[model samples]
Target: MKTQTAKEIADNLYTGVVSRFGCPRVLLSDRGQPFMSKIVKAMCEILQVTQHHTTSYHPNTNGTVERQNHTLAQSLRTYCNDTHDKWPSLIPGIMMAFRRSVCATTGFSPFYMLFGQEMKIPFDIALEPKDSLPQDTRVYIDQFLSNIKMSHKIALQNEAAQKEKDKVRHDQTARVRTFAIGDLVLLKVHKFPKGQSRKLCDKATGPYRIEEIGPNYTYGIRRISDHKKQASLVNATNLQPYIRPDPTRQRLSQEDQNIPPDPDSDSDSDPEVDQDDEVTPNVDVEATQQPTPTPQQTPDPATRYQIQKVLRGRRKHGRREMYIKWLDGSCTWEPDTCFDQEMSDFINSRWTKQGKRRKSYFN
Candidate 1:
């Protein structure tokens, strides 16, 4: 298509489908603006076509089309390397070549699969005699039907076998990771815009809290600092756990260090003597030696609590409650509303739209 406008996309879609094979029962596409636009939606609705979108940013859901596009692009680049401006004109010839070639997975050319016979090219016409057509029309029709049926059956079996092999190969190196609602994770950054150095840019950016666990290993994540949710659901492949630092260990280490004695005071010095020549007041020595009781410091309501991890979450009386493990070695079942703004954002990110609650634990 010349332009990606909704009108252009809708026109192309109508011409491509309705003019040829008629409206399909279902239309599956990515979450592109043109595919999701009102025009295309209205068109589908009028035709009674069920439209479905692949998971955002996950191309494997629509892998077949994606693979076809990749093959087409490679073919175009090879044929149109010197004639860049005329690449569009070369598409028909490239597509014909692709359709006539035998596919590894199906063990049949697309042309043969569609028409129940091999497509005759210029080379075949020049080197071989043309086969005579069947004299009986009924015989020809029956033979053609049988050939197509057998081809389709074998193709399906071959496709399934290829898929099994692909799955086995994929599983050999695949690492599975899962995140629960309220777990902090770093989102992988995939795009670096023009004029930006990819090496200088961060590989991932987040400390985003998972709000919902979705189908196909996707997670709804929101930034912890800004409380802004990601526009698209992030795939598990692009996420890594964000391990929060332990404040208790740091505090303990600080307490364990010994403080050097003051240089100005000596242990052998008299207890009542004044350093500046002023006489000390007459008071009970034991009372003077007694250590004053230090008041316990209360936690500030405005302070953002360092969450070590979220242990469990649940919806209680229309409000979300979380069992949080704090960095200070304290665990509490606090209502979502009790947290400050940033903490509240983190808590809110863990709840799904359906309000289903699950227990999340650290690995």
Candidate 2:
């Protein structure tokens, strides 16, 4: 009796058991409130259809539909095997692509059966119409039916192979760590000037004192702004340790003018020991001399900044257009424009190992 979204109800009608899927002269669903709702009943009415909520408590009668659900779910799982490990993020795209592609089920795709045409998928560039007539099509209908059966067998085998491979990969990477509470950590700020997220220059934006942590998946961060204590709990996937410009960080940048070259020439070289001893909370708050930031050749943007959304979250799946302000106790981040594609590629080309990098729509 659970209520469903309009999207959910429409999906049921489009791909559900009733949609097996000749157009319904009479529609049949359960006595669920969603189907009983005025909008839903109105749709059936508009189609000149009959709505039959099955006779109360007659569970045996709905076996055909229930069995179809299991069969369909299995088919769907086979169709979307998440082979690239990115299918979850690309679910909408994948579904959209699959729905519009040719299928073996009815000698055409679901799109074709419902809409009377198979849509040309984006990747099929060689698709061209042949000079075959619908009158000729009836002559070859039996061959088309035979082809559908063969295609289904081939697809099921491919899908099962893909699913097994995915299972193996999942088993292999089972140890990928999930974030837990009370761990000190660092977050990479999406701090790109002109909305560019590819800048390696923006990586170490925080030693952001982790304040409180969440149950197995998130952490709360607090940036020091004196009296204004601002905090946000972000997922652990978005965080990495703010490695504060380690000179020995395997690959050194061209920007080594900030810290002088390592001098093995001098002994008792314990700058770290000195700095560690001096970084007590009382000393930071109560001392006269402010701690000098680690020097770099290029003047970087001020690190501790507040970001604000210019757009509302309800639109576009909870992503917001944002502006960040620098917190060097000086206003620094210039936020006027969106840096879409060109700047991100420019930053990526700087990487020593410039493999393919995914461009997030959020960026």
Candidate 3:
């Protein structure tokens, strides 16, 4: 989207001195907005500078300038530790630092290459100012440039060494044993039931087969259930190698089968018994037994009265609750204000029951 016009890029590259220092014959840039602007194109034509542009959105074609921008930003960030937004104000410092520094690829400072002699600055001055001898500004400039060149060379060497060290470490491979489908494996069960713990050895309790490698990447493994026909999935970390079952042991049914049945001949004899015969004489038909009639008692009226009394007691208490609610809060009952005797007794009983239950729980 940023179309840099040849004139605009040239203007920024040279700052305010492009026309004063003599215009470049050919200006190479990208099809950014500043370059594609009609005004910039007209300006380039008027200045009689040839304009060249690379493919759209290809920063590598204008790599040198983009790399310079990146360096300036990085250096600017380092200088503006507390006030990074003020980086624009420090653009002059960044540009001077860049120019004074030697080029990594070409091994020459831009200032030295452009002027055929380097520019002088405050950082590299060594000798005191003199008046007797004719002052040579060129010596001061050379010393300043020489210091920057040494620093740049050292930085490049350190970068190359760090890259080599990283490459050596990064190239090493991590070991992994890939599990495939239908392979018998012992499941490394990491989690278990709430009351159960997994302190089993690496030789843990399984000879399960891999039902599936993975359904998707989120779940990495599939294991067949030991007690069912179903399968379960697991991650790589939860898996372990299968251990052989114990050879010296047998199932409970097998052990029971090895035992012999008890002998059936060991039995006790029955007890001895005696018997006798008895006779009875016949009776007359006229002597027959008579049936006795019993009287049934009627229900008592006092029982009915007791039932009505119980009902009357409950009704009286109900009226008292309603009267208390109206007197205290206009018939809207609340815990704080409705304090009838019946209600207080009921509340106290319930609190007592609740307290007993709480104590039972703790006990």
Put down candidate 2 lDDT per residue, 128-218, tens digits, no spaces: 6565555677757766666666656665776677668767866653432354444445665554677555754556454555666664455
Best by TM-score: 1
- Among all windows of 10 consecutive residues in model 2, the one with the lowest summed lDDT is 308-317
RMSD of 2: 20.8
Candidate 1: stretches off by over 4 Å: 81-83, 126-134, 192-196, 249-363
**Candidates sorted by TM-score, best first:** 1, 3, 2
Residue 332 of model 3, lDDT score: 30
lDDT per residue for candidate 3 within 240-308, as digits (tens), equals 555446643423464444544223211112123221322133242112211211223333322322211
RMSD per candidate (Å) reads 14.5, 20.8, 31.0
Task: Sum up the clashes in candidate 1.
Answer: 1
lDDT of 3 at 100: 78
